[model samples]
Structures are given as C-alpha cells and as structure tokens.
Target: MRALSPPVGLPMLAESDLVRQVARRLSDAIVQGRLAPGAKVAEAAVARELGISRAPVREAARLLESQGLLRACPRRGFFVRALSAADVDELYDLRLCVERHAAVAASRRLTAEARAALRRQLGLMRELAHRDDPARIVEADYQFHRLICETAGNSRLLRLFDGLASELRLVIGLIGRLYDDPHEIARTHEPVLEAIEAGRPERIVAHVDHHIGVAWREVARLARTLSPTPGGAA
Candidate 1:
C-alpha cells in the first residue's frame, strides 16, 4: 500500500474545516496516483501523520467515498476506488447527458463575458498541454467544461457537473499516459469551443458527444488492460 502523506502544517481549524481540508489533500493524492487504487486508507495512520485526531480523518474518508474516489467496507475502512470499464461507461454516459444539455443552454445565448472566459480557458488548456505537467493539463481541460456549465446558468446543472469533479480528475490521471501527444489533447477540445462560438446548440452537442465518446473508448481500453486475466480467480 502506498503511504498517505499528510498536508503540511494543518491549522487548528473547525471540525468541518479540518475534514474538508483532509479530504481535498487526500483526493489530490489519489488523483495524482500517490495513493494506489485498492490500497487501505487507515485513519489512524493519516491522523497520526497529520498530527490530528482520527475523527476528522474518518470523516474525510467518508466524504471521499461519497465522491466515488474511495470505497468503504465493513471492518476494512476505506480504500481508493478501483474503476472498471462499466464505471467508465456509466460516468461518460452521465457526462454526455449533462454536458449535452449544458452545451445547448450555453449556446442559446453566449454572452460576451462567457465567450471571453471560454476562449481564455481554451487558450490556457493549449498552453498547459505544452507543459510537462499532466495534472495542470487535466485541470485546464476541466476548466473548459466548467466554463460551459457556468455559461448554462442552471444552478442544478452546475452542481451536477461539480459533483463529478473528483472522478473526472481521477480518470484523467489514470489515462494520462495514453495521451502521447499533448498537442493532441489540446486539439480534441478545439471543436467543442468552435461549436460553442458558432452558437449552434446541435453542433455543440455533437462535438461534446464525440469528445466524450473518444474518452470513453480510451477508458475502456485502460480498463481491459487493468482487468484480471482468465483463470486468475481471486
């Protein structure tokens, strides 16, 4: 099992604040592959390392479990969630449904500020792709989608998208190696922005569907590679 690193010098904040901070740090570590999937997340170990109490660490693990980033078992505590092909399919399907609606809503009336924000995110994504940091690239990619969700102006829709943030970052982390060319990553997102700029809802939806469809395929491939071999029963 990979070791869970404590956040540097945690402040003596409120219980909820401590839990949230611990959750965020743990989530980032998991997304960055610092915490391997299926590895046990011992609250005692984490709490000890952070110089905090186990209560907050336990609460943080529960929060991560709710985000689909961790799994909790009876008497087994928490472990990083091991994703499967089916999980990938389901996630992408949900994203397709939500994002298609968001794209349409965003395209209905692309305000000047929204357009500028979208363009800025796109440019940042392109720039980040050129860098050697996969995490930054993934974040920039997320920003692009988030910009569209914000433009949609539907609070519920935005919340739905926000809820998927952790899983999406984990997926990108898992498949970062599959993206051999950073420029290609940037290129895949270009059509979505162009469609939005065209102010065509159907076109935007089509572009989003295609983008997510490609990602689904990549995730499926990774899943198959990670699956157990035949006759290798547990």
Candidate 2:
C-alpha cells in the first residue's frame, strides 16, 4: 500500500496549532501532487506520519472537505477531489468575471501603497520563478491577482475571490508548470500590472481578460488531457 509522505523537515505541531497545521500539511500534499486525485486520504496513516492523533487528522480532513480539496464518504473515508475539464472551465470563467471587474476597479482606485504592494508581489514572483519553485510561484501568482481584488475596494468582491482560493490553487498545481520557463508565468502578469498602473479602464479590462482567458484555455485543455472522459472527474 502507498503511504502518506510527510513533508520533509516539518516540525512537530504544538497543541494549539494541531488542526490548522494538519490541514495545511494535508493541503500542501494535495496541491503538490503527493496526494493524487481520487486517492483515499488515510487518516490513520497521516496521523502516524505527523505524530498526531486521529482526532486532529479527522478535523483537518473535514476542513479540507469544506475547501473542495477532499470529499467525504460514508464508510470509505475522504478522497482527494477529482476535477474535470468542465470544472476547470467553470472555475476560470468565474475568475475571469471577478478579476476583470476587480482590475477595472483597481485601476480607478489605484493607491500609492497598493501600487507598491503589487510591485513587491510581482518581484517576489520573479524571484521564485528564478529559483524554479513552481509551488511557491503558483502561490505568488495567486497573491498578485488577489491583490488586485483587494484593491478593488469591494468587500464582497474580495470575498468572492477568497472563496475560489483553494480550488484555484488545486487546479494550478494540477496543471503543473503552465509555462516551460516558469519565468514566463511571471512575465505574463507584467502587462496586467502595467495596465493597472496606467489607470486606463479599457486597457485594464483587456489585459485582465487576456491574461485569465489564456490561463482558462490552457487549464481546461490540460485538465481534459488529465481526465479524458467528457466532464468526467479524475
């Protein structure tokens, strides 16, 4: 039987941090492909590996279930959620809508502090890409877009973006190195930031649409490759 692989060099969790730490470790496993689609997440094995009790592991799985990373079964326990091409398509569709509007809003409301924050995030993405760390790069990529949503000055829009966070992370991880150079991923966002900085609503909308639309098409295509059957989860 395949065993759960504990994340290397992680310290033992303290009492207060058990559930969140377990959930984060499990989430890292899922996003990094250590836990594959539809694979059973054995609570016992995970607890053993993490040197924790079954209770925290169970609670962590439930948390991940709410995040759409795992689905619960009555007797069989939790399994990693399998995403279909349709799932990817739908997810990006929502992102395109949310981000396009958010970018337009951000362009109008661009503050000096917000601009610096976005630039800092972009720099971080470039550095992470240079180190060839895809997982962290994916995270930085999300933060770049998330910053746009936050700068939009709409609490509800930011909330909408937050809701899609985990599933977006999962799908991007599954897509795995969307660009060959990894630096290309960072490069693609340059125009979006430029458009925002320019404070042109039409330019912001166009760039945002193109950026997300490109990813949407690529992710959908790759998802279909990963799971061949029409609308079938894998």
Q: Which candidate is the best by TM-score?
A: 2
Q: TM-score each candidate.
A: 0.84, 0.88
Q: What is the lDDT of residue 139 in candidate 2?
A: 85
Question: How well is each residue in 2-79 modelled by candidate 1, as lDDT tens digits?
Answer: 999866554545677989999988987787777876777889989998999999999999999898888887776788
Question: Highest lDDT: which candidate?
Answer: 2
Name the lDDT of candidate 1: 0.82
Q: After aligning candidate 1 to the native by TM-score, how far in Å is the CA of 53 from where it should be? A: 3.1
TM-score of 2: 0.88
Q: Please give the range of 10 consecutive residues that has the lowest summed lDDT in model 1.
A: 225-234
Q: How high is the CA lDDT of each candidate model? A: 0.82, 0.84
**Model 2 lDDT per residue over 1-234, tens place:** 999886554344554378888998988888887887777889999999988789889988999999998888778788888777788888988888899899999988999999999999999989998898877987888888899999999999999999999998897786554667888888899999999999898998899888888878887777666532222134
